[model samples]
Target chain A: MSLAEVAKNPAGTGQKLKLQHLGMVYGQDAESVPVLEDINLDVSDGEFVCIVGPSGCGKSTLLNVMAGFLPATAGTVTIDGEVVTGPDPRRILVFQERGVFPWLTVEGNIGFGLSKLTREERRQRIAHYVQAVRLQGFEHVYPSDLSGGMKQRLQVARALAVNPDILYLDEPFGALDFVTRVIMRGELHRIWQTERRTILFVTHDIDEAVQLADRVVVLSSRPARIQDILTIDIPHPRNISSPRYLQLRDDFFFWRNPVAGRDSSGPSSQQQPCWRYGISPFSGRPPRSFRRRLA
Target chain B: MKLPARFRPVLFIVLLLVGWQVAIDRHPAQILPGPIAVASGIVDLLRHGILFKYIVASLFRVTWGFSLAALLGIPLGLMLGWFQRGEMAFYPLIQIFRPISPLAWIPIAILWFGVGDSAAIFLIFVGCFFPMLLIAMTAVRNIPSIYINAGRNFGLSSSEFVTRVLYPAVIPQLLVGLRITLGIAWLVVVAAEMISVNSGLGFLIVDARNAGNRYDLVVAGMVIIGIIGLLLDLAMRSLENVKSFHWSSSEE
Candidate 1:
């Protein structure tokens, strides 16, 4: 989805957000540093767009700009024909950290931003999303009691309950263990299939990008610019270890290992799509340290 | 396996009281109050209701002053820390003011706000504000950018982003900051009352000292302060425990 498409109609179906040439910079005066550059992006009505990139890439920056938490140093970001200067209830962000209010239970967290609906309507919406996320028994549970995967699921349910125009996720599964991550991936896809609301996902996981996005927008390393845009045609249940998947993954990581055999104190261009790639499943043998994490 | 871990502390308190009673038996009643004398003094104060009155007065001061500080401090701290440019503008001032002791502000507070309730209250606010703000800002600053990013994906507006998204995410640290501020508030309460207050527990001790430093009343007053502090701390602790569990299930 491009800003041009979003602007032409202004009100585009369930489509609620649009960004054009959004760029972000931190600091002021002499030390001002650019974080995102020349970012042209869009979310078609109910389309799930996953942004994948190398480490330190501006993926999160792009999402923050869309959410209106950070204003783009240049370029325009419009949502439903309105320009964004700050956060709105329309676009909600689901962070990796527990975003649930400590004082509010799972049910309350899901109901956090629901001022638009009547209390009864809000409760019904909460109930629906709670059931949708498989958190029926734990609705009264405090965020502290849930496991990592369960917490993320609750966040998803919470965001869904509010019924925002778009849902933004920043590596929501990046911190989970491999098993939990796999489980979250499945749960996420299931939720997305039902809601079909526009989702702008930022992840360092190539497989996660490939699995979730209709089109994966790969970003470059720091001062991140768009590197490549790959359209993944494979449907759900795509195998990551399959030849085509591996080949795409290889290309996603630049198709050549900068440090295949060479070892150096420097970065060695060995940077993976995400932190997990340090284990390099392509090596055929999991490094001893990586094996310890499995244990 | 069922033995109480707290048994030793209870035993220790009992033995210390017994030793006090025994010493008082050997010493003069007027000079050294036995455990019984202090217990009776406590009951007498309760019966007279001065103890309860002082408790209310002190609780009011602590709650209001600390609340005022928290209201202003937390938001300002979060703003300074969340935005890089704001941090650059405000951090130097925070660093400079953070180390100044709250008690040191007593003279200035009296001069600015006058001696009665305002002086005492200003001291309490200052006592808690700097430290609470400092910790809150640090917490906000250290929050990974990922949390803010998550707020955007949900289509949350700026206000919601801060209050709904960013606020809850930094809550674990906010609780830590609250713990620190509560302690600071308690510390300031007595010292703040000491300057001019005529009715708090601090005044009780000072008035007792003026009446020839009557050990029994002095000891009684100190005990009252300690007990109330302990109870308040316990309340804050339980609040945190309940909140921590709630936070886990919702946001984790």
Candidate 2:
């Protein structure tokens, strides 16, 4: 079947992903440290969910569990009522490091997962997505020759070419500079609108979450559990200057900040509360206890 | 004034020839032949048809020995690298043998093959095998897990995974191993020819020294061997010049 038809039906027609009491613990006995706890979430089909959390939070572990790279310690994740076993091609994960194959050219990487297609169909699909990702002249060029932003775009194209129903992006733009990151976010948002794939993106950037997500899922620090799930009622191509946009963004900032837990007012501090956390919003070392991570 | 890089080697050779002529003027031709005498020796051999015969004999032995080494070593390496159990069973034995030089294998080769082309080829094979095997094993082991994961996710069959993913990933480094092994094989064949056979460059050098104490002929044989080794290295280097193979080393 064509990717559009598959996207329309998806693996789960109604509910795309279901997580219940999902918890992850590393090591055994006294050494074992819990990374996630009592996490329960239900995502609808074709929804764009942005999961925002602190730096050391278990967002990545949760994404890995959902992508079937890691197994949950306590609970189960089901898609279409079937428990997740291991990584499936139908649910592709886009990593931040630009996982485009360095050995292969742009076309080669895009056509990597298109082995099931007939030769002609593979060519057509590869061409379509290459254009979709806006990499026109670089089809024959190796990824090493491409710019950093171009390489990441090529990676996104490779993921989309497979026509996966769910795209799990783990800080896909985290490595890029500010300008490129903004541009990438716009391109990604446009692609999501066109493809309508269910995306669960993890990031520490609240502005990014506010700009892109249909619903933002806020996560607490280590051994993270769902703090709150705020629906972004603001429309797409949201004006950052608008009162409603600033209000929604600050609302997320207030919920995540520990200090904000003290005072319910002062939404103005929402300017960029995510930059510095746990200490004063200005600067100083985080508490020694928070800095020490177990190996 | 500085000459171009290509002329530097030619200039060095000319200066060496002038020095050799001066040295030969002071000494008798019996003990040390001059460049002129060595050139005459080479011409005489070529006129007598022995030059082509010796060159062909050495080339033939090297081709058989090095080809066999590569055919066996590369696959064995891939297997040992791919399967941990295979490596566990075989690697200790390889480690034991790898330290010994191919020259040490000369006695065993003579005993096994009994003074012929087979003995010479066996020595060359011993010289070439271990380096190729180790390099190929390293190449396979060094491949990033991401590539394997990508292969699996893309639905590549096990055979396709090996041929398409593993082979391409391993080849650039393997080519480097092949070049080094070829150099070793060339070195071994000469020594092997000196003892076991009487029809190669090595045999020519030994025969020239022993038959009539023809020092000029011996020097000529050494010169021929050096030139041929340089040509083979150049041929192998041409593979790296190819654009597709060039970028492979830069890949993660």
State the DockQ of every prediction: 0.33, 0.40
Model 1 chain A: weakest 10-residue lDDT segment is: A257-266
Q: Model 2 over residues A10-75: C-alpha lDDT tens digits?
A: 333468799999999999999999899989988877888899877777898999899888888999
Assess each prediction's global lDDT (C-alpha) against the native: 0.75, 0.83
Contacts from the true interface found in each model, as a fraction, amount to: 0.55, 0.25
After the best TM-score superposition of candidate 1, give how far the Cα of residue A65 lies from its true spot, in angstroms.
Answer: 2.9
DockQ of 1: 0.33
Task: Report model 2's interface C-alpha RMSD after superposition on the true interface residues.
Answer: 2.3
Judged by lDDT, which candidate is best? 2
Instruction: Score candidate 2 by TM-score against the native.
Output: 0.84
User: Residue A96 of candidate 2: its Cα lDDT?
Assistant: 79
